[model samples]
Target chain A: MRRGPWLWAAALAVYAFLYLPLAIVVVYSFNDSRLNAEWVGFTLHWYDVLIHDEEMLLAAGNSLFIAFVSAFVATLLGTMAGMAIHRYDLKLLNFMALTPVAMPEILLGVSLLLFFIQVLNLTLGMLSIVLAHITFSIGFVAVIVRARLAGMDDSLFEAARDLGASPWETFRYVTFPLILPAVIAGGLMAFTLSIDDFVITFFTAGVGVQTLPLRIYSMIKIAVTPEVNAVSTLLMLLTLSMIVLASRFAPDVLKGKT
Target chain B: MSGPPFVFLLLFFVAPSVIMVLASFRYPGEFGGLAPLFADTQTLHGLTVETYEFFFSDIIYGYVFLKSIFVALATTLICLLLAYPLALLIARSPKKSRDLMVLLVVLPFASNFLVRVYAWMIILGPQAAFSQAVNGVLALFGMEPVHLLFSPFAVLVGMVYVHLPFMVLPLYTNLEKHDPALLDAAQDLGANVWHRFWRVTFPLSLPGIFSGSALVFIPVLGMFAIPDILGGTGDMLIGNLIKEQFLGTRDWPFGSTLSIMLTVTVLLIVWLTTRLAGRGRHYA
Candidate 1:
């Protein structure tokens, strides 16, 4: 069969559609003028301004802290759930565990906000945001870990048990080593989701708590400033590198195989 | 044990859902707000189906709901059309090249979605690069440059752009798993390229198409950012409506009603797609 010219053209066009916008953003971040349309001489003034911005730095710190803590908690809980699903075979539990990803962000955000403010009487801030992140992040981590557990060799666990190893010892000697890559992958996945989250975080992070995405949202809502472009460019670079590294290190996780 | 995650889900996920459901049935207070269930048992005495009634009775809300579905459907269809060929090409490429192509699809998703949307804003903004380029071409034909920014078209563009990768990724995954032997056997049986693809390859790819549709449709249906940023006055999606209820209108009961309705609609769509796809695969 002959490969057609149109196929290559279509693929190229799709790639362009996917990437051209980010290229434009990166290019304009260094544009010397306020108006993104006309490019004057290039300058790194936006980066200089961003480095000096106190509020943005604080927001970035809060986001990093929240992501790290939430990801850790999510990975721990999710690994437990994944093990339970593998051992127990409760189909409904499995379904319920993975359902959060399919739920809309606005719905999750609003419902959590209502629950925290009204029912729990918990003040909305970093704690609320972290809890919300864990709530959703748990679903993703469970999914990755569960996929990893499903493809695991059952004989290895049985052998450890047959050797009279205690449950803890078997897990430590056998299951832990096999699922470590997935655990790390899930942690990375949770970290990325928590960091990039906007809607759920927006609803939960009441007054005075601003993450990087929230901060960018406020700036963009007012004006598409060079500082925002600069910040976003750096954020994009950071996230892309994380994802690439994750994909390389834990290829199975990306495939939904483990 | 499953104790930790199950408890967390019940407390955080299920409990909130129950609250939203109960709140949806109550009446808004005098201030167009909802008192917490514990705050006032008095409001519970006045509990009514008024919020749901408002949703059912109001044509505006119904229109917004339908508009959300319509936009989601359109975006899904467009993404599917654009994604199928790209997925096929990537699936057919060499090993190293295929990985590169797949990375290209995923790289955009890893970036901040809001920033990508903002990129569209610049490109589609008035007097921006895209407009100037188009106008430069149109000047030869003596036609005016069309307004692309802050319009429905711009919103559609942003929606499709943001979601194209989603559609492509699932399709690529499923397509990559297709057996080349099936196509080769069909060819040996004297089936031409068109017939082989239509009879075997296309039918096998339906699962990918369905899943890709589900992935793209659900998010686009409830998406607030894309529409909020690029949309003009007339582009109110269900997400925008829910946001308005909580923040702008302070109508928590009606907001809860809308939220519940949107969730049910999304769940229904997902269920229906899986069912239909399963049936389609069986027939194929």
Candidate 2:
């Protein structure tokens, strides 16, 4: 069947719609003028301003710290959860592992906000932010690891067991080697998610703490500035590179198949 | 194996959800402009339905929810319109080109959510070329130049833009599975392109459409950032309202109450869509 010209045109238009705004943002970041209304000349003024902004730097520090810690913990728990869901037919485990993934961010954010201050009496700061990040990140890691598990050959485990290996030895010898790429990919994914997260971090990171997204949010809320644009461009580049690298290094894991 | 994740989730996810439910029922203390936490033993002990009653008593909160529903519905529809052609094209494309097309869709999504929204703020801002050109047209008609930023239109645009990928990915996944044989069979039966698509391909794509709708609709319903950033005076939705109750109003009970209601709404929508999609698929 002939794919018509209109189909191509429509798809192209959609692609443009998806990209044009972002392109404009990137272009205007170096526009050499405060007013993003018109481009006068290209300059690195925004990046200069961003570099000098201490508050923004501090927020970036907090975000990176939170992301690394949460991603590490979430990966450990998620790898286990993923293994359990795939190896055993535990409905409860499946539900627990996946439900939070499906839950809306705002709901999770608000609920955790309440949980921290109201019940746990945990001060909302880096610790609270890390906990919240882990809560959401676990589901992501679990999903990726589970996807990797689903594509594996079950006979490998059976063979290990037949060789008189204990369960731990079987896992250590067989599963760990097979799923390492996915574990790393999932960890990277969890890291990306934790860093990019805005809604959850917004709620959990009380008055004192500020993450990059939170800082960006407050800046945009006041009004758009060149520094905000510069930071956004940099952030977009950061995440894009991470995802590209993750997918590149873990092609099979990214594809959820061997 | 599941013990660690289960315990972590039970503490952070399930416990918070349960607390949110309880907090909705528990009384709030008048605090010094902060979330009225469990103030005293008596207030904490009592499970009063005052917050729920307060929601039911006032119509404004209900109106905000209705408006949110409307915005979410509209955004979903618009996203479907934009996403369908793109998804169909990608699904039909050669295998070599398909990944590139999908990556294009996902690349923009890889950017921070706030950055994505900020892109629109610039596009819709008065001084931007798009907004200026729009106002220029309005000037020709001798009509009042409209403020595009901080308006419902901007909010809607931001919502659709943010969510278009969600709709596309699911639809593409479904559409990619359709057999060429079915379309060929329809063509041989004297059905033209439109009829073949409407009868066979479209019906087959219902499951995809429903899943995409659920994906788009639920997130839009609870989204506060787009509306908060783009909306003018009259564009408050349930998200904005719930956000205010917690952050601005500092009323945790009412905020929790609103969240419970939002959760129920999402659950209801997802359940209904599944049932409806199931029936539609059976017929298809």
Candidate 3:
């Protein structure tokens, strides 16, 4: 059977559709002209402007801080949940682990907003954002860790136990090392999701606490700017690098066979 | 650690959602806000279908609901068509190339979704590069530049661009697990490529396709940002409508009711898909 030209053309078109807008953003970031239409010449003016922009800098800092702390907390909780579900024979525990993923972001955001506002009477800020982020991020981590744990050989733990290790010691000496890469990968993914998230953050974040996405959304609402193009380009590069590194370092774990 | 997480979920996840549902039942009184539930029998009278009726009876609301579904369905279908070949290509490529392709595909998702959508606005807007290019091409054909932004076309383009990866990754995973030798065996039996694909490959890959469709369709149904930016003033999706009720109109009860309706619809689709997939192993 002949391989048709249509198939290859279709694939190319799909790839172009998926990537062209992003490529345009990156290209325009370097365009000397402020307008997205005309490319006068190449310059680093946008990057220079971005570096001097304090608000963008602050938002970037907050985003990084949130991602790092939230990812760490979610990883710890998720690891425990994954271990409990996989190691123990509790069916209900497994169901509980899966519930968060099933819920909509809008619902989750609204509820968290209400909970913080009405019940706790706590002022919304980075703290509430981090807390809300961790809620969903943990579910993602648990999913990845559970997949890794399932594929792992149980005999490794058995061997550690036979060597006179306590359960904690066994996990530390045997299980933890095996799943460490996956845990890290999961953590990276969680961080990415947390930072990329908008709907939830839109609700949970306070009036003063504007993440980069929130800033971009507001700016877009006003009017599109070349500065936004520049910022998005930088963000796209950072996120793409993280995802590529994560995928490269932890290949088999994400493949769902551990 | 064991019991505490469960309690946390119950309090944070479960309880809040329950409150939102309960809040939907309370009526806004003369004071123009959510009134006390017990104080109003007129509001809580067993089951009041007034909210549902109001949503359904209004022609504009009904039109928006149908349009949202159509847009979502179109986006899902486009994603499916694009994803299948890409998945197959990734599956067949060398390991390094395959991994690179997968990374390339997944990497876009890491950037803020709002930013990505904003990027699309630049690309599809009146003065966008694509629009200019199209105009240039049209000038060659002695035609004029056409308005593209603030149209359904723009919304669909943004939707498909944003959600394509969600469709691709799942399909790739399922396709990656396919046995190459099975195809070879089919070839040996004198089955043509199309026949082999229809008889073997397509059936095995249906589960991924169904899942991909569900993933793409459900979220796009409630998508707020893309429609708001790309769609015309007349285009109001259910998500935008809900947003108006909650924030613009300050009608929490009506907003909550719409929320419940949307949530229920999503849950039903998920349930039906999973159930059908379970029964049909080809799809599953």
Candidate 4:
């Protein structure tokens, strides 16, 4: 095919736009001076500060805690739902499964807030945030697990059943092993999303329960600082590394295959 | 799926959203929160179209709403334009290259979305690397450095940059499934490259385009942080407005009404896009 110069130029421009900011962020994180524009001598002062910053460390820990717990619980429920939907002929189940994905975050956050505040008369805090995270995280896990189940050969399960295996035994010995990769991939995706979430967490979080994104948001509102750049650079690297690892080991799972 | 999952959806997703709709219709309290839905005549009977009227009639609000829609539309258009070629490239690339490209795209999505937007802040702000670079280059031409951050243009740039991957992945998947022999047959039939793309490739990629647009447009409509950080005070979008009503002004009734309005508008647009795409498919 004869390639156009204009096409290549446009693609390169877009790719640059997508990446240049991130590159700048990473570059500036190591600067000795706080001034973002000027190139100062390279130093690890900001990272050292980040290491000792107790509040930021605590917020990061809280975020990790919430993400893992929510992802684990959501994955469990998602696996059950995936098995049930695939093994049976359920009407309107697909639409129900897709509802959380389709609904806007603001809508979900507000409604969940109202339910907790008005009906349940419960104080908003980490539990509310975890509950909110689980609500959407489950949908993600279900989508991936269900896709895996669809690609799976059902005769294996039938054969297990025919060989004097109970339904639970069939699931434990055959079905579980087959869909495990998808479940792990989905769980990692969910954890990343839960950690990254700002809007839903903002609505549901109570006073003094700051996640990392919330902390960053507050800092951004106060001022744009090199510290935030440092934080973002580290986060971007961590997420990119995890995603690369997942893509390497489990390409089909990440692509929504069994 | 059968009983429990359905019940969970009904109780959580369906019921809560329905309550939000109902809450929008309720009267405003004296303190500016939502009054009782079944309040007395003094409150409920006096329910007016005032909020909607205010939103539509005020030039600032109207302009902000229009600009947001325009930004979202421009973002979607840019994403489509960029994604098509990239998707085509990935689809036609060697298998290893395709995997590498897919990994590149998926990496950004897995990261913190706010952090990525924050990354743009560092690059576009007054003291940004680009600002310095541009200032240096422009000094040769004898011009001062131009302001880039805290502007509508910056917001549009951030929106498009962040959402580009969403558009690319779907288009790549759909385009990858197409048989290459069709393109070869078109070439054999004496169709030029441009004609082949317009008549054969473009129409076949409509589903992917629709899916990508849906993915980008809906979330961009409800986005708050991107505009807040990059857009600054004067460049408020609908998301900022909705956030202000809830947090700043303590006007839950008005905020709920605005939420309802935004939700309805998005649903209408999604329906319209799908219908238009369906028509395009049929005609093509």
Candidate 5:
């Protein structure tokens, strides 16, 4: 069979559709004029403004803090759940654990907000956002880790037990070491997801508590400035780097054909 | 062993949702807040089915819900059509290029989502190069310049643009590993290109197709941002209705009803897909 020009044309056009907007954002970030409509000349004025904007910086810092903390907690719980699923026969547990993922983010966000403000009487702020993030993130981590565990050799754990090792010792020596890469990879992914979550964060966040995504949404609602473009370009770079690092540790997760 | 994770999920994820369900039954309270569901059994009197009735009886809600389904289905179909070719190209490419293409597909996830939506706003505007070029060609033909920005067309464009990668990633993953030898074998059996694709490539890619469609459809059904920024008032979907209920009207009961409706719809779709995919596997 011969390859045709039409296929290549369609593929190229799709690629252009995917990349052109990001390219435009990047290009306009350097535009001399404040308006994204016209390009006067090349300049770094927006980047300068972004750097000097304290609110954006604080929002970025808050996002990083939330991502790290939530990812850490999610990794812990997710790994425990993954190990449990691998070791135990808890069909109901597995179903319940993954339901958060199958549900919509808005539903989960509103649920958490109500539970926080009504039932628990907790304040809605950074803590609520972090809790919500961790709640959703744990499901993702468990799924990834469970995939890794399914591929792992059962003989390693059996052999350790046959060598007169205790259950905890066998897991500590063999299972933990083997699954560490997946745990770290899942954590990185959690961090990635948490950093940019907007809808969930919006519902859970209190007055004055802002993540970068929330801040960007507010800024865009008001106006789409060049500074927003600069911030977005930087956020893109940060996300790409994090994903690359995660992929390095868990290529299977990224290439997840299964 | 599973106790801790189970407890965490039951407490945070499961319980809050139960609360939402209960909250949906309570009457709209002061300032549009939900009446207290737990004050006493006497408060049970406040629980009513009016919110659910509101959704069911209102033709407006029915219209938006239908529209959301339509948009989601259209987005999924468009993504499937567009992404299949791109995924096929990537799968057939050299290893380096394949990896790069996959990276390109995933790269957009890192950028701020609002910024990406905002980018579409810029690109669709009258002053933007894409519109300018189209209008320039239109002028040569003595045609009027079309106002595409803030239209349903722009909304469709934004939805497809944002979700294209979701379709492509899964398709590429499945297609890349498919043995080209099967295609060769089909070709040797007197099959034309279309015949070979229909009999071989398309059947083998069912899993990817289902998975990709599920990924694209579920989110697009509940998506508010694209319609909010790119669409006019007519393009309002269930997502906007739910958001307005919660944030604008402070009507938690109505919002919860919409949320539950959406959740049930999403679950049904997931179940249907898995069943279909399971059938596909048995055939394979």
Candidate 6:
């Protein structure tokens, strides 16, 4: 189609649509006004308020902790699943790992909430949240790792097996080193996904546990405040850097292909 | 290697889904959750398809389900329209700049999505400049000012904003793969740009469009937080209803039933879109 006049305007408008809400957010994070409805001279008062906000700080801590643990477990499982699928062509494992990521977040969240309360009788708190996070995150890690594996030639593993090395040694020496970048990138991707996740975390969180997204949800629901904006800005920065790092580790992961 | 991950998924993912199905068939506990399931009372302990009956008993549930579908479809259409030009521009850019452009489209994580939605809350608040400007215009016509934050318009804006990138990425991926020579051939054949696009570009992009629509539509179908934050009281969707069962009303059975309905609806839509898109491609 044409790229000269109308196309550029359309593109500009789309960009504005995408960025304006965020610009409003970032701009208001520093706004001095309590209402956050308008700009009333720039100040870092909201940041100061966020710094002192105990509940917000606690929620942030919980989010970081959940992201760390869930990402670790999910990466481990996902890397295995990725390798297993690549090496053995396990379709069931393939579906199980990937479907959670693809399915609507609420379905997963609701199902987990039911499972926790009914079957396992697990207490809904940090462990429940971590387990839930891991469930969804494994798919992402498996996708990246499997992608990395698929791009590789089969000869490397064949060469290792041809040597005197055992299966464990072959993996430790060859496969581990080769997919480390993808694995790291996958873990980082999982980290960001876990940290930014809201819908899944919402249902599984029960009544006691509160993550950053949950806190922000409640805050925004109750009333808009610059502190929420401040927290959102900082959380965005945190996840942004994590994404950049992930991409640096494995550029194709950001493009999201196998 | 497969044993561990497979076992983990069976325990967590698959089991939960199965349990949800079971829960949907059972009665809601007198208190909430599983008290009634495990209670010594025989009647409450007995499994029934009552939740399913209750679901179809009233047209209200079906109406909400249908509304959710309409919302999802509208959101998908709007996202496709908004994302197409941007995706095209990115796909058409110089190779070096394409990555940067795509990254920019995906970069709003810098505000995170919750904050992104909250940004709308602020902008559409009654006292905010955007709302005031809108209301000021309405005032010129002697119409009543609307509460923009808790309205359907706010919900749509939030939905379109959050899901735009999903549509953009898929289209960009597809558009990037198109042969420029095809467009050039059409041009040399005296086909206008609009003709070229409508005939060639769009037909080829059906798969991308379906995939993107699935990515957007499926999620929006189950979204609760957006409507919770941005929509009015009457703006309840399937997501909010399911949420209400589990959280608000504490009716786990009904909630699970609603959830099952949502899952089924999502699956149906996915199946339909893929089939339609597949047929479209065959014709193309």
Prediction-by-prediction clash tally: 0, 0, 0, 0, 0, 0
TM-score between candidate 2 chain A and the true chain A:
0.96
Pick by DockQ: 4 or 6, better one: 6
Q: CA lDDT of A234 in candidate 3?
A: 80
Report how far residue A182 has shifted in candidate 3, in Å.
2.0
Give lDDT for model 3: 0.78
DockQ of each: 0.70, 0.70, 0.47, 0.49, 0.63, 0.73
lDDT of 3 by residue, B1-284 (tens): 45655565666677777877865776654444355555655545343556767777878776877788888889999899888887788787777777777766766676678777877777777776788888889989999778778888888988898889889888988888888899889999999978988998888888888888887998898887788888888777888887777656767667777788788878888898888777658342
TM-score of 3: 0.91
Chain B: TM-scores of all predictions = 0.92, 0.95, 0.89, 0.90, 0.92, 0.96
Which residue pairs show collisions in model 5?
none
lDDT of 1 at A202: 86
What is the C-alpha lDDT profile of model 3 across A2-93, one tens digit per residue?
23576667777777777777778888888888678767898988889888989888988888898999898888877777777777855675
Candidate 4 chain A has its poorest 10 consecutive residues by lDDT at A249-258
Query: Can you write out model 4's per-residue Cα lDDT over B1-284, one digit (the tens) per residue?
Result: 35665666666667767766665655666676566555766644345565777667778876866777887898899889888887787677767777776666666666577778877777777776676788789989999777888888789888888888889888888888888899889999999988989988899999889989988888788777788888868888778888887767767656777788788878899999999889877866
What is the C-alpha local distance difference test score of candidate 1?
Answer: 0.86
Q: Write the per-residue lDDT of candidate 5 for residues A1-258, one digit (tens) a residue.
A: 234677778888988888889989999999998778988999999999999999999999999999999999999998888888877856777887777776656788888887998799998888999999999888788888888889988998999999999999988899889998889999999999999898889889978698998888888877778898899889889988988899898887665542
Q: How far is A152's C-alpha from truth in model 5 (Å)?
A: 1.6
What are the runs in model 1 whose C-alpha is more than 4 Å off? A256-258, B36-44, B136-145
Better of 2 and 5 by lDDT: 2
Give per-residue CA lDDT, model 1, range A26-104, as digits (tens): 9989999888887897999999999999999999999999999999999998888888888898676676667766877
| Most TM-score-accurate candidate | 6
Per-residue accuracy of model 1 over B201-276 as CA lDDT, tens digit each: 7899999899889989999999998888898878889999999888788888999999999998998998899999
Q: How many Å off is the CA of B238 in candidate 3?
A: 1.8
The candidate with the higher TM-score, 3 or 5, is: 5
**Higher-TM-score candidate of 3 and 4:** 4
